[model samples]
Target: MASPGIFSEVRDPSERVRQLCNYACKVDIDEAIPPKRYLRSGLEMMRMAKVYQEEGNYESAFILYTKFISLFVEKLPKHPDFKTAPQADVSAIKKKVVASFASAEKIKAKLKERYTAIEKKRQEEEKRIQEELARKQAEEEARRKEIEELEECKRQEAETKWLEEQEARLQELKRQEVERQRQQEAAAAAAVAAAAAGINSGAPPNFLNNQIPSAPPGNLSYIPNDFGGSTKLVDIDSQPAGTGPIIPDRDLKKNLLINDGPSVSSPLPSVDRTTKPPAYDHFMSTGSSSGNKFGLRDVIIPSDLPRKFLVKAEHNTLKNIETCGILAGKLRHDAFVITHLILPKQSGTSDTCVAEDEEDLFLYQEPRDLITLGWIHTHPSQTAFLSSVDMHNQYGYQAMLPEAIAIVCSPKFNETGIFSLSIERGLVEIGSCRQKGFHQHNKTPPLFEDSSHAKTVDTEKIEVADLR
Candidate 1:
């Protein structure tokens, strides 16, 4: 039972390929084309495929054409009806299937060409982004190296200064030691002279020991010197002293201007250099399995559509009566492009218009594979806005497909607007309300807003089927 209609909603291209395979396996080929209206309905796929191709929706066109070949060229011949059918019917079917095979092949070639160009452009863009990222990375690396070199040079300069200060302190300490040596020599010479005087004058030699002063307590201490019987003063303060008041060093290591490494300098800010390819629109969607909450895809409205419909419905407008038309089209490139504006047989009053025979609309759409995207109507004398009645009417279309829209045109007010019921609020309000025609409802959080998913385009001319 799987058919082209099953693909009306947006789906991933890969999933669709799998679906096609599964469909082929499960399909009962013998029962595919049943008797009664088989001959008439057999051509429906071809008709719809031709419409897709003519409308420039190549993806949908290609799919329909392929399906047509699968059904008629491959499946129909195996059907029970075909085995007992008249020779003329069989001959006619064979001729159409052969022609369809040719059309499908032609469209396949076009699709190949279209996709090849798209892929080439995408690769070029990707290469450009990669090149840009590589260039930036190189610049960051060079900057980091420059900072490291500068910091190293500063560290070397600081180390050299510290060494020079230590050398000077060593020289100063040697000079101080020499001066102490000279003083000790003088004191020893005086003691020896005194001892000689004491011996000559018959005084005690012990007086010489008393004349010499004891060394001071603290970091300073005296030791025996190489010079005659004199004690050399050793500056033990050159090393760290015993526990007492702390003495400041000639050079404090913490205050020295030295660079440890690159960690000292500010690090470069991180940048996200990765880039992703553009999303494939149209028939390709990576949407969730739950389906698009707002429905399939963008619903395209033909530009100046309101004006065109107005021209067709001028008679109704002149009489101060309303006119309505069905906005219908095939899915193209993940969008429902409104290609046909059908003025279905209908009657109207100054405020509202109703289609008389809806069956006529469905009958016309069946063979063409058209989906009802939305509706457009003219409010001859009123302003371009949906009324309470209009809200209820639009709720039905939106309920069927969340992407559906309602376009309101008012020639008298020189206004035309595309609108849709608010899914969050409008749909709920209208769905619950039972009132009819021109009645008021809570308008604080208004029921509808301008359509965001629908856009007017001028790329293709819209076909008007004025069934009236």
Candidate 2:
């Protein structure tokens, strides 16, 4: 429909219907209606049609227009005043109908143009809104990436500072240890010297009472009667000696001398000493069993999985095993179980076709004290030593719960196998088997059975197509 004029000169269908109904009701059954009134009613009906057409109510306008034309034709032939009325009036009414129809057409055309313009504007607005949203999302992503980069940089800086501090402490410890050794040596030397001086000064001399020959006779000879009594002389060498004093042997003295050299020469006392201030034992005990200085588990652990899983598993048998495990553990506990949903990409019909379903597994966490024996999944193949995908999944899975084992099942025989991954001497391996229940007699030995083979696997390069 064409756009209506600002003054509403165009007629509307409902108005036309009301005008017709009014005119028809006003018609007196006792007296014949006047031609002017009938003509006025027709004009009003036409005006209503014009309004309806302008407003894009074509169906109602068409119906009203048809009724007005039919009534005008029917009454014009039989009315008493129809013949007496001025021909011009009849002509004017006819012209007005034609004009109204024409106006209705114009209104329709204008309306179509307006609708087209409005639709185009709407499309443009939607596009603009979408572009704005995209721009906002891009900005948000960039901001997030920037924040992450800043955090990583801060972490690296902290790590570097920590390493430098540790090195400085180690150097200081070495310096203190050297100083202590010097002091100990000095004290030992002083003690050895004191002992040596005491020994040298306390020894007894051998020259005692020996008789000299009679003073070489010469000096004159007066022999007294007292001197004539028996003269007895004892030689220093002739007496039988009692047990001699026990002196240190030469070897013993030599050893003591060598050992005492550093002590005697140094200037510091021999004593235990340390430069570092004493610290409380408890301070040293603050750390994880994994030896990681940072408590990464606190940050990476999932908070929502347990609650959501439990809600979804009220009727399911497996009962969201992982969620159960998470709840059983203590609050803010270190333990968490993560499961990855994996799907096979290829039908495995042909060897040449590379499977596209080789996507990484989705990770899900289980609640604590769940008494779960690790993750369980069915394998398409008969033999299940973790496939390349499985290994990749398990390794990442184990990072969150290193103590947990992985269970792989083969649906055909209902056979299930479990494997544990561990790090040993800087190498990743299927370290040990706690228990492998299925096909117990099978030749495959426990995990640690072949060290060489485990070490040969290059686990890092394996593909990890994250399904998430």
Candidate 3:
């Protein structure tokens, strides 16, 4: 018979199976039951089933246990230990074992179902988290784009306002200039009319009407006169009497009568007025021919060339010549210094060529010595560059000024053009490198070849100007 603890005492079926399988071979049975018969007995068969169950062969163990229970019930037990050799109640034991097996199966099924449900929940939670993160990222990206667009709009609006203000200022300046020109024309007409009236009235032509007092006759001596009666007269000479004028004694005639004055034919000998006269004779000397005189005077100094920022040369020599027109001025009085070369508008293109206004140019003065003589241009295309005409022009320009620089801006390549001359030595082929920062090497082919063997080209030098 099976052990009593197998089902009645063992709370865990798995533990019961382990105990039975371990003690199965040591259990002693009646010799009336042959050894082979004993091994095949119901008790032994049940132990074998439990061993199979412990080994994870649940289907085989369940079948073996069912058959053993049925056989045990059909064959009654006749053990000597039984008081009256009561027949074994195998039906009840069989029912209990079948119920344990069903319970184990149900437990296994519930565990599998729970595991599946947990895994599904975990996947759903992970997906939710990922979706939330994506949503936040998208929201942030949208906000960033919105802010950028707003900033761009604000910048564009400010630029538009600035342009409008500049246009208004330009219009007002043009009106003022027109008014000034009208006034000038009116003044000129009035002067002409006055001259005509003087001629008609037979009066002496008063060409000196607007002239101020003249300076003294000597080259170094200055004359003093009351100009608007505001400044005091400062006499520059202090000397003894009868010494003659300040003019050197070597040439008396050259320093005497500067013009046909009233004292030209006076009988007094020519004497330098710089000599001191007697204190008592001061009043009398005032009326003498050599006394102080007054007349309209003009002081003239050479004018500077008009300030410009661009000059085009026709030949290579001309292009190389350093011209004042191409120089840029230094910053003066919080003003900007800008230099630009404008090209004519291209034909058939609706685009208008814009240039910096004269008002902007008037804001600063350029340095006269740092002028750049850029390339010349004809109306060939709506561009500015060294064409054959430009090269010829540069050759001529270079001959005049060897240090001149040239830049040719062509519309064909838009912003890319040839700078035939660099402020530094050599030509720099400027084109779109599509890069940032300073260029370390040239990207284009050399425009000119060396004069030596002619096989290799000596590119233009790139260096900063040594401006003192």
Per-candidate TM-scores read 0.52, 0.27, 0.23
Which order, best to worst by TM-score?
1, 2, 3
Alpha-carbon deviation at 87 in model 3, angstroms: 29
Give lDDT per model, in order. Answer: 0.65, 0.37, 0.33
Clashes of each: 2, 38, 39
Candidate 2: where are CA atoms >4 Å away? 1-102, 203-468
Q: List the residue pairs that clash in candidate 1.
A: 282-333, 282-334
Model 1, 1-468: lDDT tens per residue? 011232322134445434433332232232422432344334444554566677665555556555555655566566777767666656666687788778766766665565566556757987997798778778877877887888777867876776565456555665665676678778878888888998999977987454774442244232222222222223446444331122234345347665454543334555634221122111122121112334445777878677789999899899999999989887654556889999999999999999998768867987677777789999999889999999988976765456778999999998898998886789778977878778998898999989887877888678899989
Q: How do the residues 1-468 of candidate 2 rate in per-residue lDDT, one tens digit apiece? A: 331222122234344333433432222210133575455445545544545555565433544454554455554547766778667658877877666556545544554455455556767987997797778778777776776676666666665555455345445544654565566666556655655665789943222422122211112112232333232323313433431112112222222221111111222333533221112111111112222212212212133332333333232223211111111111123223232222223322211112243111111211111211134344433444554444444543343333434554443354545555424311133212223222232233332111111111122121112221
Residue lDDT tens for model 3, 181-244 = 5676676667777778989999766766623233223323211222122222222235333221
Q: Of the pair 1 and 3, which is ahead by lDDT?
A: 1
Error of 2 at 214 (Å): 64
Compare the candidates by TM-score and give the number of the best one: 1
User: Which RMSD values do the candidates have, in order?
Assistant: 10.5, 40.9, 55.9
